[model samples]
Target: MRSPAAANPAPHLHLAELNSFPPPRSCLPFLVRRAETALRRRAHCHSSSRRSTQNQLHSLQIPGRISHGNPPPPPTRRVILLLLLVVVLGAMGNSIYKFLCGVCSDLSDAAFQPHGAHASVAALGRDILEFQRTKQVPEGLSRHVVSSPAAQANWYKKLQVAWKKARPAPTTPEEAGRLVVLTLKNHQKADVDGLLAFYGLPHPNEAGSAPPPAAGHHAPPAQHSAPAHKPQGVKFELHTLPVDAKAVADGDTVTVYVDTNDAPSEIKKAAAERTKARAARNYPTADALQKTIAAAGYRMVPNAKGVEVLAKKYRIRLSGIDAPESAMPYGKEATEALLKLVEGKCLTVHVYNTDRYGRSVGDLHVGGVFVQEQMLKKGFAWHYTAYDKRPELAKWQSQAQAARKGLWAASKPQEPWEYRKAKRNGNA
Candidate 1:
């Protein structure tokens, strides 16, 4: 059972006793040192991965000083060249932008620049607007306005185009004046004021309100305190004298009057003469002059308080209707009916056109009530569809017919035109 030993066995004599004995003491320290060295190598190898390597490199950095690694290889030649190129491109772009802005300032008249405007800008206001409107180069404006007709026309053409391009043409004086100054640039102040005044536009000196009336032009009566300027795209409004008891003629005919302030010169003179003659107690002369004044549609009528005032008269035919004649049935009733509606009230007549009979055919409005609508609804008038085609009139007439109101009470009522025709032909 004894194991074999080395060939030169120094006889320890008992090989079986070697199993109980340890090895040499110097070999223990050497083995322990080798084991420690192996663990250190493994730990260092495990921490040297890419992330750990990056962390090690990052920890070596310092601001403004080279603490450890070479300073990033002196910024690669390609990178340095690219940085230079970017700086140069930015500088060039700035220069180009400035040059374009300078060009724009110089060429564009609208832009504020040190052009002719820089030297001395004056007001050309309404002279500019008038020039645009008429285009007739005024005499003596050759020097003050423009150098020559060619230049004036060129300026005028520019203004004309700009005026048209400005959508919805200017309405008020202020709007017109603003547009005028903006369109025609680099003008003198006094000159602009004069030009604006010429066209009745608001002057810059007046702040923003309308200018005064022209020479020899009386202002419209203050009772209406009416807007001197009209609403855009709307027909001018006209007012009638206060309706007296006798002003209503029939359902379709009314004797309306306007203020003598709006009368013609000759009519005004006749009225004045009549007033003077009456004051002088020259009854005959006063009567003749009164007739002349009346013939010219100027009359002196008593108001609600019975004070006689001068006014211009008009025989307005209610537009779109032909009521029963005063001699026919419902004739008196129709006159009384219109009188009740319009008595002591001032009417606003929107005159569209004049009839062949020399009467102003217009839609009459008493406050909010339409005089024609009232007549048609009451069955006192027929919708003269031949002259006017308003659907509301036809509709109202149909309603009256269905309800058997007014003249519709008759089994078969005759239209006013038909009655007139019968009377004219002596057949009724």
Candidate 2:
């Protein structure tokens, strides 16, 4: 019994110890404590993980690096991200604002600015007027006359050089006129007849008399001792020498063919025949005539008094009557009235003389209607007594005055010449 039991006692004692150990302190409290300890450990691990994530994000924001150390707290990281987003958005907004501003500026410029052609023409007119007034040519007359600034400068320089080389700089109005004609002729390539018409110079072939019996050639008998001049007060007269009606320059001026034509008796018929013959020789066809008309430099420009034939390179002013300037009252009405009378009518012009400004001073007629007289009778113009001393013109003007016409309607109407002087002196 002792030998077998002793061995068994060892096993029995182990079993008893295993069952004993006072039901280890209330398992509920122990479990709770273990759970709380576990929670604390997990919270510390989460905080470390958060710190690592923030460090990684901060490193990414910093240029190029990965940080092993703890980064700023979560709240700080959130603030940095929000600030970065705001900055990025602000930069984008600023860029967009600048782009929009540029677009708006371009649109505004295009909308308000005039086209090049119109601007250039206006500039040319203004420069010419300035030159006339100051007697000195501006350096940049051709600046806007062309599309390119470089081209404009080149043309302007050339014009200046030509002007300087043309007989030692103009010293007088006549000299200036000569210089202008030369410049227009050489540089502008203008037609000689057109130029003469604009300047009120007599055309070389104006007489249209068969070339004086070409040195020894027998001439046909004279056609009745050159019809005597009808009395002084004749409303209008027709030259027996045939002439062609080429173009209407203004209310009082017109361009005529510098040649004669074969026609029966009537002056108008002769004129028509001459014009037709000239057209046949110069233009030849309808298309050709249209082309010539289109190429002509002198287009009609409406003015307060009458009209101006602004040719390609020159200007022609009407004669016999003076109307108020555009700036004066009733000036526009006077222009409109003239336009109505002669805008589309075929006219016959009698050349008289050239004025200081190189304008043609002429009398215009449409059939039997005298343009200047009509204007005066209607009270649209004043008789230019300085140059024209015709008694009939004075009578017409008196009638207009009696009717208190156009400018006469004003209490004290100012003359165009006086008005021009006042404007020049800055007193208007």
Candidate 3:
């Protein structure tokens, strides 16, 4: 028995379910937010699809469209043109960078150099390059150039001009000499050929670079020493040359006697022959008296065909003796006697200045023998009165004339040059 409004039980069942459910107010906000969020997502998806379709159609319809993954459409002619342009620009940029770097490097180098030293750097570079090229140095060689004293001197001289042009600061000569010497010493000339090759200097070996003779080639026999002459009242004392360490100690006192009027012609001839023999032997003309000097217990430096003492403490020049190539007249004989006296003794060298021929002019005293006077006494040499105005020389010459020593034996003794002229005329 239900009323008409409640005729169906279904209506009541619905009401019962509704009554069992939670309040609609709590679910309303969530349902509305979810519906709004869903609608926005669907609209966005539809719009994106439509726009994506439109973009695809547009891209496809365009001509010559290219992408990366594929062969890339033969690199569009315009693209190739653009690439070429880029390459050119890149090259140009590289070149400009290099030029700037070079300039900056040069300026920095110029700025850092010693005030005046930079003035001639360009020329020095040129010289170094030239030397390297000529010498065929290895590619890995350091760029810095080694200098010798002589070359350094030349460099400083060149710098002087550079300074004037470049307005560089002034420098002292001593400073210049030191700089130059430092450079020169670096180029040590150890061997004869090596030295000549390095400095472009000449030597006898260079003149004859021929091959040696075959085996069993007959070489000339060695020359024998001349027999010794025991002179009257000549008290001979043997000592080592000062140059040799084993020779007598430095500063050892010695006496010398000058009796130029008493030298004999035999000794003079012997001396001249020895000189000629030495010259033929390819020996240093100056070292002709080496054995004698060394025997005297002193080391010798061969200078321009004459000998010079090479001791640290004492510097001695052989007196009255000029080697063959040094000066004319009795130079050979004088050298010979000086040698004979100095052999095997530690004698003292009284050093003097350079003679006219740039020889170390000094008196050699060995075992109490005045070597210079002995040569003069022997009539082998005339007193170099022009250079040395020793009055005793004049007296000795007169005495030599009276004694008729060596060349003094000539009734009319001619000077060496005059004799040479007469001989040349006779030959002519």
Candidate 4:
């Protein structure tokens, strides 16, 4: 035994003495830890494999099978039951949260909201930021956009730009509102005004009027500026008109219906009788009455909601915007956008006058959104500068053109009006 052992000399002894000596004192702890850690890891891996194999005893032979690289899982039934319980609990919690949210708001909700516009850029920016957040301004800003720091930064940047553009610093509420209205184009008025009211700002009665000076502040020199008047002849307003998809006759046109009670007495009488005639199954009499009603620029038609109502029909041509014809580029898009916006909604129409084509030309508003503003900004229609010379319209068109949006995406987008002219002249 001694002879054999001496002859062998244990090959590992050379590596222990000749190739590697005792480690330096400074690194001894590290070396010890590393070696111990490796051994523990090996032990742990072996134990884990053994434990995993043991756990799968009650599992399916295939679904819970352990492969060379894969370890078996616990019983599928237990896992499924646990997952289902978790799902049910999650659903119940969500339902409760929704119900509570619907009934009333949490007191802590207002903790982050700014109390009012403090007449400073940063303060107003914060106020508007909160307002936009609470009201979901710009219609539907996604969380991805809203959650980023850029949301606050971009809002502040816009406020600064609008503030600088406003020249003299705004002291009162109306001027501030006007600034907001100008800056936040394509926003609904109700949302804008709600923000203003929250900040103790009043709606601007006339965009041209100067606001009253703040409390204890001396009056600034009265700048004499005449009230702006529309060149439109006999401007009138249609209190409300319900429109629909079928009513959208063209990109630049819509057919709006008002209640017969708002119509002329003669037309009202005719509409009333037509209802009775139809109810009594007197088709010929109803047809004759319908004709009489149509002669007064009125007709009975079902509204966007599909309710058959006796209404006064008006052929409405969108003012300040000339959309492409149906055959022209983006024509269908313009009509569809308008219909989607106005259909199933009651509109507030400011009728300037009837156009030469017997279509009532006016500004259409729904839920405080300016119809023409959206149309122009979206590049669905031209500003029709020949007929309407609003600087705002031109600005919107320029922005769209610069951004190459919608119709402007074309290399050489033709004006809808010009396209019509070329068609009339048979040049294209």
| TM-scores of all candidate predictions against the true structure | 0.44, 0.32, 0.25, 0.47
Model 2: what TM-score?
Answer: 0.32
Tell how far residue 133 is off in model 4, in angstroms.
20
Q: Which candidate's TM-score is highest?
A: 4
The lDDT values for all models are 0.60, 0.45, 0.39, 0.60
The order by descending TM-score is 4, 1, 2, 3
Off by over 4 Å in 3: 1-335, 417-428
Q: What's the lDDT of the predicted structure labeled candidate 4? A: 0.60
| Candidate 1 residue-wise lDDT at 136 | 67
Shift in Å, residue 422, candidate 3:
9.2
How big is the positional error of residue 104 in model 4, measured in Å on the Cα after superposition? 17
Q: Which stretches of candidate 2 lie over 4 Å from their true place?
A: 1-316
lDDT of 3 by residue, 144-236 (tens): 223344444454344333333332322322232223233333332222122222222212212233233234422111111111343222233
Candidate 4 weakest lDDT stretch, 10 residues:
219-228
lDDT of 2 by residue, 31-96 (tens): 334433443454466674544433332322321223346666699889999999999999999889
RMSD of 3: 24.3
**Per-model RMSD to reference:** 19.6, 23.4, 24.3, 21.2
**Candidate 1, superposed: residue stretches over 4 Å from native:** 1-236, 303-307
lDDT of 2 at 294: 34
